[model samples]
Target: MATSESGSDQTSSALSDSFRTPYYCEENVYFLCKKLSASGTAAADGSDLFVVFISNEKKQTPLWNQKASKRADGVVLWDYHAICVQRKKEGDTPLLVWDLDSSLPYPSPLTSYVSETFQPSFQLFSEYQRFYRIVHAPIFLRYFASDRRHMKDSAGNWTAEPPKYEPIVAEDGAVHNLNEYNEIHAADVMTNAGDFLNAVFTQRLGAVINENQLEEFFLKMP
Candidate 1:
């Protein structure tokens, strides 16, 4: 994945375009970020930058129509969405997240973004479930752990020595190796100038999200 050393917006957009496809966000964050960074290093604070993919526990609202909700036993379905997160070093500076589709301020502080994005329906027992993986790009790429990736802390960040690509189980129980997976799908996600904005409008992919939904989500925040 090639990127230009331009402004942050361009850089971010470039990065997102390179990652927006169905599974690239997950794979690239674990494998590509550090290699692609202009400086072959971590941030000054020693905290690693990360790319986070998130979604409600359901298949994406399909382009044509929403899918009927269904779940068996312990199965969890995932839709598609990705963002950039940078851990704060310390001091008063806040930990922030960057999402291209968000109406909130770009690079939103984590506390505020979390409070606004997840709103419970009931005060007593309402809890929305979310699953995430955070890869510590620098350490994982440099000094890897013995496991494919190891949990280093409660924040869900992972660290591990880069693995030699091998057949791994996918969400649907299919076997795939990262190398083949990227070869097939990477081009599908890579975008040229203006391609992303066009996809946003034409595909109705939540590029222009509903302000009312955001307002309602926040209004219910406590």
Candidate 2:
């Protein structure tokens, strides 16, 4: 991994150039997962690619080390954010997190990413607490669709420029279903750890987990 500051900056810049847009984190992560799947770095079937959605009931998620923040601390309150996590079957390799908007290393180790980005040790109001929804990348890539409607103002002005590329459509031809992935509720969180893990890998919407459970849940993945 790129441990030096300069090396990390270069790697992050290159990844941003390849897969990032101004405000389309979901699409950025979608393409990232697609590339990882095609690279055959995960299982041959790409079963190890996971997409993580971060937000809370109030849509206020405070993440540190984001490129979008002007604060000296690099903390940003995003309505929602998306990132890709890849788990290698090899026991010696740590899981990796690919976040286009993060100022962290291009592919930070899952533990480091969770610690620095989520800052679980930092206390916050209930509304500012973060929740996560983890989806199997293969299933997400097949069913995730977006038309960029979420970026518009009430009068239909673009909040930010849409990606130069065409909007993403699901394999089944569905479009504009972005809310299904972004809207995570605490009620949806699974109480049983086994059920949560199973749903995360097998269910369409996957499972919702709280910030405290994020690291543990992903670490438990095989």
Candidate 3:
């Protein structure tokens, strides 16, 4: 088990060191879910693991306390970001978020991760407002494929080096289906909270919810 010190600046180095990768949050999270599921920290079938993608129609979501930021406030404007959320079914463990890019503690409690990272109290322009796509880890793992094409410029040069490992391909042999998971539309926002909760676990792409509903959405998860 990865142990964390209360109020530590970051999660135990061991966990982060094992999973951290630069500019590949989605892939980093894919393997993190695998670790949690295989290690038995999550449910044996991995139902306890969820992938929460944060972004907006503009792909201009601003998040704070990200390790990638050089600013004193540790803020970074991301096109999209991904994190692993663990909601164990066993004894009352708080919902935990594993963000490899965050300066916040590794596997931070969902509440703290939301309050500090999302800063819902802080107002933002409509274009900068954040949206979340919550996908079950099992479904995400099986279907999430990324060719890393988005990282390239029009010139086809590598904007950032990709992982040395081969790109992820879905079990069904789909390549470059990343947009299916990263893209969120304003029209798709679930108006009924009850319907959103139920759809999140059942749908392959999961459900899209706005920033205000983020913490509450996960808190209400089974």
Candidate 4:
């Protein structure tokens, strides 16, 4: 459920879906949470890599209440048209946006590619093969931003440019056919996020994926 807090330096208040949107920039750590806090994770307030977001609680529904992605009902998609326009100004790569509905457990979109719960070894392949859905979780976006740094539009002018994307259907029936988007997934981002937390809070199961391991994994992707 969304809340109304007085605006702060880290927040950007605006209109979205006809209601006020409260975007909070929080530390990346806020993305981490104990197993109990499903809908109410911590915000980036001031201490860590500030992650920014708006709570969509004004309406009594899941943040992804609009409708599920037809191809991947498991995919809570976000249309980042506005962010695309803005990114063109900063020469930043446009982002893909969507919030996950943890209320349900989604089947792994990559189940067909290989049969293993995500593990360190799974990182060794083209990103397309390793990650689920339309795109790989974070590396794709990071590369996108990197690519946009010096992008030039069709005008032959290097004005801050937006990316161009063509959606294609994956074997999982998920679609990857857009640009300027963001997906906040419980399955991809937090499902494993919780794995890390579980290791920290309770008994460790699998070896945790370190940043270097992740880097090697994604970098190995073509």
Which window of ten consecutive residues has the lowest lDDT sum in model 4? 81-90
After superposing candidate 4 on the true structure, give the runs of residues whose Cα lies further than 4 Å from its correct spot: 1-45, 49-68, 76-222
List the lowest-lDDT window of 10 residues for candidate 2.
Answer: 1-10
Q: What is the per-residue lDDT of model 2 for residues 35-112, given as tens digits with 9 covering 90 to 100? A: 656655446566888899998889988999999999987899999999988786665545888888888877778888
- Report the C-alpha displacement of residue 114, candidate 1, in angstroms: 0.8
Q: Encode model 3's per-residue lDDT on 1-32: one tens digit a residue.
A: 34432433332455567766799998999988
TM-score of each: 0.37, 0.91, 0.91, 0.19
Clashing pairs in 3: 11-106
- Judging by TM-score, tell me the better candidate of 1 and 4: 1
RMSD (Cα, Å) for all candidates, in order, is 17.2, 2.8, 2.8, 17.4
lDDT of each: 0.37, 0.82, 0.82, 0.23
Write the number of the candidate with greater TM-score, choosing between 2 and 4.
Answer: 2
Query: RMSD (Cα, Å) of candidate 3?
Result: 2.8
- Candidate structures ordered by lDDT, highest first: 2, 3, 1, 4
Provide the lowest-lDDT 10-residue window in model 3. 2-11
